[model samples]
Target: MDGQLPIDTRPWPVRRDAALHDQTMQQTIGVVTKRLANAKVTAYAAYPEANHWRQRAVEVKRQSIRQLEEHLATFTQQVESHGGKVHRATTAADAIQTILEVAQHHQVRSVIKTKSMVTEELELNRALENAGIAVRETDLGEYIIQLAHEKPSHILAPALHKNREQIHALFDQDALVYHTEPPASEDIVALTQYARRRLREEFLAADMGVTGGNFLVAETGTVVLITNEGNADMVTTLPRLLVSVVGVEKIVADWSGLIDVIQQPALSGVGQRLSSYTTLVSGTRGPDQWEGPDEWHVVLLDNGRTQLKDTPFEDVLSCIRCGACLNVCPVFRQVGGHAYGSVYPGPIGIVETPLLTNFEVLPELPSALCTLCHACGEACPMNIDLPGHIVQLRQMKQERHMNAIGVTRSYRWWARFWATPHGYRRSMRWARWGQWWFVRHGRIQSAPGLAGGWFKTRDMPPVASMTFHEWWDRTRGKRQ
Candidate 1:
C-alpha cells in the first residue's frame, strides 16, 4: 500500500486514448453504465409526472441562487447560533488549508472520510497522508478504490470500474492479514462484511470525520447528507470533530426542496424513491442531545463555482451531482469517468473543466466531446440545460481565440457549401471523388490525413454518386 501510486492526472486526450484501447475497462464501463441507464429509464417510466417534480426542484435552486447572499448570511448565523463554525473557502487550496488548520488545532492523528467528490477535488486525502495523519475511507466503494489507489469512476458507485472478481481479490488480500485463514468465497455480502469489520476500528479511532454536503439548507443552516452505505452517518456521529466540506452551489432555501432533491438522484442511481439514508445536522451534540459530533464545521467552497453565477453556465450550479448525465452519455459509456482526467466528467464535466480549471494547462476540449446528442439534458432531473452549457463553452473557446485556425476555416467553408444547392452539389462531387479510393463495401473504413485517423476508429458514410434531389427528379420523370 505504501508503494501504491497516486491517481494519474494525465491530459484528457492521453487518458481517452488509453481508455479507448483498454478492453477490460471498456467492458466494465459499458455493462455498468448500461445497467444504470436502463434502471433510470424504468424508474422514470413508473413516475409519469417526474418532469413536473424536476421543474419545481429547478425552481428551488433558482430562488436560492437568486438570493444567495442573503441565504448564505442567514445560514451562517444559524450554524453559529447552534455552535457550529462556518468557514468560507474561496478556492480549492483555501479549502484544503482550512481543513489542515482545523486538523492541527484539534491535534487530529487519524481521520475517517466518507465518499466526497469535493474532498477529492481538494486532494485532501493525499494532503493528510503527506502530513503523517492516518486517513481511512469508510464508504465501501471508496474503501475498495482507496486500497486500489484509484479515483472514483462513478459518483454514486465509486468502484464501478471494478468487477466482482477484482473486488473479491482486493478484499481477499485485505482479509488475509486480519483473519486466521484467507477468505474462501467471492460473495459481495461477504466482502462488504469484511470491509465493515475492518473499518469499524478506524471509525472508533478517528479524531475527525469529513464528508460532502448534499444540500445545505439556508432556512435552517442544516447540512443534508444522503447516502446508501450508512458510512457517512457513522463517520459524522462517531468522530469528535465532523466536517462537511462541500461546494457552495449545493444550497437550497430550505428542507421543503429535499423531496425533489432526494427523488432525482434516487431515480438515477438506484431507481428508488429515495436513498437509504437522509441525515440533516445543524450543530454539534448539545447538553440536551445524546450521541453526535462534539464539534461541527461546514466549509463552503467557492473554487470557481461562484464565478459561474452571473455567467452563461449558471444553470450548471443547479446540479445535485445526481450523475444522471454520465449514464446516458455516449462518450462516458465508452471511455468511463477516468478518461476525462478530472474529478467532474461526462457532459457537465466538459462544460465545467475550462471554467473551474486553468484552460492553459488543459487543451480547449472540442464540443465534439459531447456528441451534441442532448441525452444528458434529457436525463437531468434538475432540468439543467446541460447540452446548452457545452454549446456555450464551445462558443466561448472560439471567442477566446482557442480554436485552431485550420479547423475553424474548414468548418466555415463546409457551412457555406452546405447552405446552397449549387455549392452542395459541387462539394458532393469533390467528396465522392476524394472518398472513391477509400470506400469499401459502401462505407469509408479508411482514408488519408485526419479523416484517416478518425475512420480508423469509426466507419464514415460514403458520399452518394447522385444527390437526393437528382434521384427524386429522375424517379418522378419515370413515373410521369
Candidate 2:
C-alpha cells in the first residue's frame, strides 16, 4: 500500500526470476516450513485422534458443498435479519466493482485491511489504490510486504522471508511518517512495537476496513476472523464501514460444521492450539457496544468456484486456508510461493489455478515436481487427494497435446513394454547387459550419453541379472 516500494506487475517469467533471486525468501521459507512441518508431526503424535477428526472434517465439508445453495440462502437471510448487507459476485471483476462502489458510497478515502488470501487473489489493494484511495495493511506480516511491494511468499507467514535486519531497514525507510526515527535495536520486541504503534494510528484514522473471512457460518450468518495478533479485530471493529470479502467455497452448513472442520486445521497449521483472538461478528454493532463498527457488508466472491462443485476437485473447497499443505510440499519448500506465478501457491495452487482459470494460461509447474508421495493429501484436513488432482492435470495436458516431448515418448515406451510380459522381460535382460559400463561397486555411477544427466545427482542401482518373476519361477520349480 505504500507508494515508495516498487510495484511488480511483470509477466510470470520476470516474477519467477525475481522470486528465485530473493535469498531471503529462500531462507525464510525453508526455516518456517521445516519448523511447522515438524511441529505438526509432533502434534498429531500427541493426538492419536487426529485421523478421526480429519475424517469428520472431510465429511462436513462434502455435505456443505452438496447443499451449498440452501446454506447460502440461509446465510443471506440471517445476515439481513441482523442488519448486515450481503452482495453476491460471480467473478473477480464483479467483486472488485462491488467493493469499490461500497467504498465510494461511504465516502471513504483511507482503508485498513487484515491479511486475506481472497483479497490478495482479487488484487484489491491495487484496485483501491488505482481509484485514488490510500490503503494500509494492519496484519504485521502483510504490512511488511505492503512496505516491500512484494507478494506473500507463504500463506500463513506472508513476510516470512524478512529477518530482523531487513525489517529494521524497512521500518527506517517509513519511520518519518510516524514522527519518530526507526529504533536502533534489531530485537523482535522492538520491531513489533514499532509496527504496532504505526498500524494502530492507521486503524483509528481509516474511514473503512476490509478483511477476509476464514469461515462463514451459514446457520447463524456469522463471519469468523481468526488471528493471533488481534489485527483483524481492530480492522473489523474500529472503522465505521467494514467489508469482508470471502470466497463462496468458504461457507459451512452450520456452526457445528465449523466446529468439526474449520478450527483444528487452522490452529495446527500455525503451531498453535488456538489463536489468541477468535471474533465472530454477525451484524453491525449496536449503540450498547461502546466501540464497534456501524455498517457491515459481506461480499461473497464465486470467482469460478461454482463450476467446481460436485466434481473430484470440489474437495479443494474444504481447505480452511490453514496452509498445512504448503509447509510439507517439497516443491513449495524449494521454490517458495511466488514461483507458482499465482496468488495461491503449493500443491493447492497447482491444482486450483488451472481449474479456476479453465487452463487459459499454461502453468509452468512440472509433473516431476511432485514425487507422488501423497504427503500433502495426508496433511489436508479435507482429504482433498492433491496427488490425484495433479495426475488429472497431467492427463488434461496430455489430451491438449501440451505435454513435453520427452514425457510423451517415455509414456509411449512404458505402454508398449507393459502390454506384454515376455517383451518386458526381454528388454530387462538387454538392459542388464547394457548397464555394465556404468556399474561401479554394485551401483551405476553414471550412464553413457543422454541418460548420464539423470545420474548426475543420484546413484542408480545396477539392474539384476534375472527378472523377479523368472527368479520366483525357478525357485518354485526346484522346491517342487
Candidate 3:
C-alpha cells in the first residue's frame, strides 16, 4: 500500500452512521465474520486438545505480562549478542523517530513492509513518507487498502470491507498507472497474480524492510512472524536493513513459552492450523550467510502498555490480535471496524484503544461498542476477560461522569425499578399498557425515545396480560 490518509478523525456517532448505512460494507463484514466464526468452531472441534492449548496459552501470556520486564531484558541481551540492535521506545513518537533514524543511517530510499498493526498504530508509513522515503505495504490485502487510501476494517483481513468488484476497480486503476493490463476477470487468482508481479519488483529494489513481531522469544532473541503470504520472508531477506516494531508485551520468557501460544492467532482467528508461512529472525546475516538482512533492529514499544501492568487491565495485554472476538460480536457485525474509528477494531479494540490512550481518546468506546454478550471472552484464545474489562472501563467512565445526565438517570431508574418485585411488577404493568400504541398484530413493532433504535431492526413480543408471578399468586394461593 502507498500513501494513505490519517486514521478517520470523525466523531464516533458520525463514523458509526457511515458504517451502518454502507450496505456493501455491512454485507461483506457479515458474511466474512460469520464464516470465520463458524470455521473457528469446526477447527476447535477437530482438535481434541484445543481447550487445553487455550488454557496453556492463557497461562503463558498471563505469566509473560506479569514478568514482562525480566523477559524484555533477556530478549534485548540475546538480540544484541546475536548482532541485532534493540531500541526501547516509550511513546509512539519515540518509535517512529527510532525507525526513521535507522532508515536514514542505512540511506534507505524505498521501503517494503509486511502487515503490521503496530506500524499502523505509529502510522509508520506516513511518517516514512513525510521523510521522503517511499513506503509500500506488501501484504495483498494491505496493498489493496493502501491503494484505496483506507485503514483496515478487520485485523486479520485488512480489506474485509471490500468486495471483489470494488477490488477490481482499485486494481484496474493501479494497472493503468503501471502501464500494465488489469486482471482478466474479478477472480482471486488473477487479482493476486497482478499484485505478486508488482510487489516482486519492489522486493528486489527496496533498501529497507519493516515488520511487526507476533512473538519474541527471550531465550534465543528471536522475532516470529506468522502470515499466509511469503511477503514477510522477502521483506526480511532482500533488504539490507530490516526493522521490526513490536509491543513490549509481545516478548515471552523463552521458546517453550512461544510454543505454548504460537498457534493461537491462527487457530482462533481464521481456524487455520498454522498460517502458510512462519518466519523467524534471530539477527542480521552472518558473513557466511547467503541470505538475510545485514542490519536488524527490533524496536520494543511501550506506548502506555507498561502502565497497564499490575492493573486490572493487565489481561488486555495478553491479546494476540487473533480477531476471533470480532467475528462473534453482534455490535461489530453490524457496524464494522471503521465505525470503531481506531487502528484496532472489535472487542479487543474496544478495551485496547481506551486503555492504551488512557481514555483520553474515545472515552465512549467501552460503553458504546459492547453488547456484554461474553462471547468475546469465550472466543479469545488467551481467555482475556474482555467483557469484564469493558464493564470496569464503563464503571470508570461513570465515576468520572463521562456519561450523559439523561442516559445515566434513565439507567439508574431502570436498575432501581428492577431491583425489587413490587417495582418490577408495577413497571411491567406500565409497559404492557404503554406499549399498546406501538403494538400491532402480536408484537411491539416500534417504540418511542431511546427504545426506538432497538425496534428499528427488531420487534419484541408485548408484555403478557398476566405476569408469571401474578398467575402463580392467583392459582397457587388457593392450593396452598
Against the true structure, what is every candidate's RMSD?
4.1, 4.4, 3.4
The TM-score leader among the candidates is 3
Question: lDDT by residue for model 3 over 383-476, one digit each (tens)?
Answer: 7889899999899999989988987888898999999988998899899889999998889999976688889899999988887888998989
Report lDDT (CA) for all predictions.
0.81, 0.81, 0.90
Off by over 4 Å in 2: 1-23, 47-54, 176-179, 366-368, 425-456, 459-480
> Across residues 71-169, which tens digit of lDDT does each residue of candidate 1 receive?
888889999999999999887777888899889899999999988888888889999888778899988889999988888987777888898788888
Better of 1 and 3 by lDDT: 3
Q: Against the hidden reference, what TM-scores do the models get? A: 0.91, 0.88, 0.92
Q: How far off is residue 392 in model 1, in Å?
A: 2.1
CA shift at 395, candidate 1, in angstroms?
Answer: 2.1
> Which parts of model 1 have CA positions greater than 4 angstroms off?
1-8, 176-184, 358-361, 364-368, 432-450, 457-463, 469-480
